[model samples]
Target chain A: MDIVCDKRAGGTLLQVNGRMDAVYAPAFEKECLLVIDGGEIKVVVDLTGLEYISSAGLRSILVSAKKAKVKGCSIQFCGVSGMVEEVFKISGLFTLFSIVPTVEEAFAA
Target chain B: MMKPQGIAFRLASLTLLVSTIILAIIVGYNYSVSRKIIVALAEDRGTLLAKSTAKKISTAFMTVQKVIDSVAFSLEDDRLTEKRVNELGQRVLINNPEIFGSAIAFEPFSFQHDNQYYAPYHYRLDGGPIVFARLGSDDYQYFYMDWYQLPRELERPIWTEPYFDKGGGYELMTTYTVPFYRNRDGQKVLQGVVTADISISWVQKLISSLSSREAEYVFLLSRYGTFIAHPNANLVMNETVFTAAESLEYPQLREVGRRMVAGETGVVELNDLPMTGDSFLYFSPLPDQHWSVGFVCSKKEMLAEVSRLNREVATLGGLGFVALALLITFLAKRITHPLRELTVSANDMASGNLEARLPEATTKDEVGELTHSFQAMRESIKNYIENLTETTAAKERIESELRIAHDIQMGILPKLFPAFPEHREFDIYASIEPAKEVGGDLYDFFFVDENNFCFLVGDVSGKGVPAAFFMAVTKTLLKVVAESRLEPGEILAKVNDDLAEDNKSCMFVTLFLAIIDIRTGVVRYASAGHNPPLLLPKNKDAEWIPPLNELVAGIMEGTQYTTKSMTMHPGDTLFIYTDGVTEAMDKMNNLYSEDQLMVVTNQCLGKSAEQLVDSVDKSLKKFTGGAEQSDDITMLAMQYLGKGSKQEGDDRWI
Candidate 1:
């Protein structure tokens, strides 16, 4: 799994690609924690290229969300579809957070 | 003198010799026969090719002849005069690409209005337009030329010998001439000659493309043996086959020319032809021309196909012979592989390795049968030996195990009587006596800290080696946990969790674990489904303590056990033992229960810890009444007298 981050006008755009299984979940969580700790308040996760995600990956995202909320930072998601969307729906994360069609729309919202 | 290796080498050599000799004879014979057949086939092919070429040349001559006749007939027309003859000649030259040029020449005073001996010629120059010129030059006279004189003499059409018309047609060419005369008072008088020129290059192109080999070629020869349209440009119109015969002093070359120029059509093999070397020649004559077309190919070139085939055949034959020899060697080994294996196996079996096996043989031949027989023999012998070995091994194993288990169990017990003889504050004793070859009953007591004494008695779930192994694990776990200085309950909990993890065998132990404070006489004990101790007080009754309601150790993970404490006065004893003592069955099947153990403990009131434990063991032995002990019997007794001073030396009691 790859986590690529770049700064945008509205926030930091974090593009995640490849399968976010249990193996890569820790690194993803660590990077997320580092980003939130660094005070980058607004973040948009672009998951358009994400192939699959397991429960461990979702747990990492939840941890990131909670930590970001406590730090007064925010995270939005975009390009949610395929197996990643299926995992979100099954894990009830679909209605739990913000999601949009594109990175631009995600930040705009 | 012939060993196995020697015989193989002999066989290979003999086979190679025979194969090489036979291959040489066959290749030699095949080469001779194929050479003869190929040469014969080439002769037929050459004769057919020459005949076809002769037909083509004849057609070209007839075309030129027709054109000359056409020009001669046109001269008889009154509308055509000497003035317009050049124009007609130019038209004839331009109409046929095959014709190099054409011309019409008249005699002197033939036409009264024309100049005497006037002639006009039109011919192509290096692929340009037809060039017109008068033939009246003093240096070259047209009337004296053979093309003019011959037809004038014969008063007929004739083809001239092919020549390099350098100054006339400007090419190597042949000319066809037709003479025309005008009737003078019914007496025909000679007028002039009409000539049509054809480039020999057209015939040369047809002949050169016919042969493929460099040494094989076709050429044209005139009636007088002059070279015409030969593949060798130097020989065309320059040297003849007769001249070559004369130069090389080989008369066969002239004979070949005679054979062609006589209008003969046949294939001739001349072995000593000059310039041509040994060659095959075929000739045929052309119509309306005194010329013969012949095809010649060197004998070496004709037999080149046979030589190539001979080399290929020899190579293939040798390769095939080598392949056959290798296959024979491989097949011999295949037939003998089983026998070789059997030899090795028998040797190994003699050397006392019973695991040696016969190689499998799928063939039903003698070797295969021998292999199967050997397999059966080996199996039976191996089985008989193994059976005897297993019986002896079982007995020895049991005896050794009993000896080892007895030694280990006794070694682990606290054999020393006044276990704390130097301290004088307490006395402890322990022993384990197994009923069978091996047992799992255990008892241990050690000082954990300066003020605390750790004690434990355990019986693993089963008997024999498995139970003994679990007992060892439990003892070690308890000892390690006790060193943490935790409470009895916490220590037992930690030991239980550690042992329960990865306890796939599901073996468990019932233990009474305790920590005693010597200075305070306070005893805190935790029990895991064990028989409680009999507490003996001074001047009071000895009684059995109630059991702790806890599961056995190693049964589960994270099981919590609670501790129970009791304050003891001085001169009190806690006697701990497994059910092996209380449940001991006599010859009459009557068990010595808890009440009996309490009574026996009370009877040893004034004894030391070692004496108390010894007395209990003696009672249990007597109660069994000579029957084999049913289970492992283990016991531990600790007596708390008074707190002895730290400086006191109590070596007298040991």
Candidate 2:
């Protein structure tokens, strides 16, 4: 998995690619936590190229979201589609955090 | 024929070579030095002998000259008669035994007028009685003889070359002659000659007696280089030193001969003489006779004693070297003996024999220290192996216990088929395969009342024993809460509150719980962050039952859950599964996504629930193609049949 972080006017944009299964899930969580620890009040995670996710990946997302909530930081996800969209809907993660269709939409929100 | 390859052999051989060279140098040097000293001493002795012999011969000649001089002085008397001359000659002969004869010869008509040759002679034979005779007859003219004529011409006394006197003395002799003069009217005129004769036999005997050693000999040379007395009698008086040198092809001997005749006295080495091999010649001249004496000593005979002594010392040194080589080899072997034994023991240990016997370290040396260290190493290895064996056995026991736990977990899953046999309105089948010996995936079904059947499928956050325990608690709480005959969402809410009360580990389970009303074919279900189930209509395609918006159970307390209802026709089927089904990975790490699940479920629209579950399991296995199941795969399929739709010959439900 690869994660590319970009600084934006409103938040830090983190673009993640490849698998987010049990093996690579921790990398995404670490990227999210790093952006939050760098004093960014908002984080936008772009998973447009993410192809698959496991239950372990969902747990990492939940843990990251909880940590961000405790630190008064907000984390948003964008580019959810296909299997990733189905997983987010089933796990009720759509209700837990703000999700948009693009990085620009996340910044506008 | 293979040479010795041991260090002992090499050490001994090296020592022998070095010592042999050193001993050879010492013995050789000693032999050469002693040889020089012995040769020098022989030369000195020879020189001394030649000088002494020359002095003795000189003294004898001086005595003969004194006698001859006194006789000639008396012959100068003016009134001397032949009788007086004969008396003078006899007196000279009787007084000197070495002289064989004496003669007094006058000038022609000078002594007696009538006779032309006139002389008188007196002599003796081998110390016998003295005999008197006339020395000058017609056949023996004294004036023409070398003894008389040399003194007349030179006007001085002289010794003549040796010759045989036939008529006068009848012996081989050399004469010493002196001239007498008369003072006639103030002019000195030669009157006659007087002589004393010495036999050459007496001189030869004297010269031959001077030699002391067996290989040593002496020779006498005349002033003209003639061999007067020599070891070879044939050469005496016959061959001169130059003729002998020519016959022998010895130029060095000829050189020495020249020096001798020139009255030179010294020692020289004669190396070119074939008869003498190598020799030293000591020559000296007789002072009065002008004769030379030579002493020849062979160098080989001179150094014989020194050579023998050197041979004995070398032999002893050889014997000592042999003994030293043997001693060195024995000492080297003794030192390396323990090392050889250690090699054998180490080989045994290398071949997996930890109990190989080690040689005792008796001495406090390097080999001994190595042996001690080896024994210590062996002991440590043995202890380490023992500890390793014990740890492995403990791990095996834990593995076996996990197998039993897996069995118990499977046993609690309601595995009996044809469950609720008397009720033929629905058919359900479920299976759970853990990725490990135990897993956290579970599926359970139980009737909360005679008209209500509740079923649940759940997956904990992770795998293994902790997840399995959480799964069990969730299943039990769902069963307990369902017994209260509440709605699906109310039951899930109560169970989640009970689970989150002590969930410090933050572990949670995704659960889908539902109750089917067999009388009306109405299904009410709630999902606690679980995957949505696929619904397969008897005559249409498969579609998912949209999931509720709720967090997974055991994450937080007081989390409310909402229930959704669905009406199923007589041949419709519902399939629920954990993410282990859809997220199952192939060797390429590609997931068996929900799209494949939807296609396979549509194909199983008219199949029984058991057939549908088996088809999906086989499809997953085929897609994975021996890839390791990285998660637990739990699947449940239920097909509802309207009331009174039981088929004939399907008495499996009876």
Top of the candidates by TM-score: 2
Local accuracy of candidate 2 as per-residue lDDT tens digits, B1-654: 112886667777888899999999999999999988887787777778789888877778889888888877887878777777777788887788888888888898988788777777788865588887876777777788888899999999988877778866787778888999888998988998988888887787877765667336888888888888887878888888999999988888889999999998899998845557788889999755678988887777777788898989899998999899778878878877887889899999999999999999998999899999999999999999999999999989989999999998898899988787788889899999999888989899988898788888999887888888988888888888899999999998899999999675667888999899987789999999998889998789998887675888887789899998989888888999988998888999888988999888888767888899999999999999999999999999888887777872144322
Off by over 4 Å in 1: A1-109, B1-7, B164-167, B201-203, B209-215, B270-278, B298-305, B330-654
Question: In model 1, how large is the Cα lDDT of residue B169?
Answer: 70
B316-427: candidate 1 lDDT, tens digit per residue: 9979888978876666666666777788998998899868876877899998999888888888988989898998999899899779877876776677766766777777
Candidate 2 global TM-score: 0.59
What are the lDDT figures for the candidates, one per model? 0.78, 0.84
Candidate 1's TM-score reads 0.42
Q: How far is candidate 2 from the true structure (C-alpha RMSD, Å)?
A: 8.8
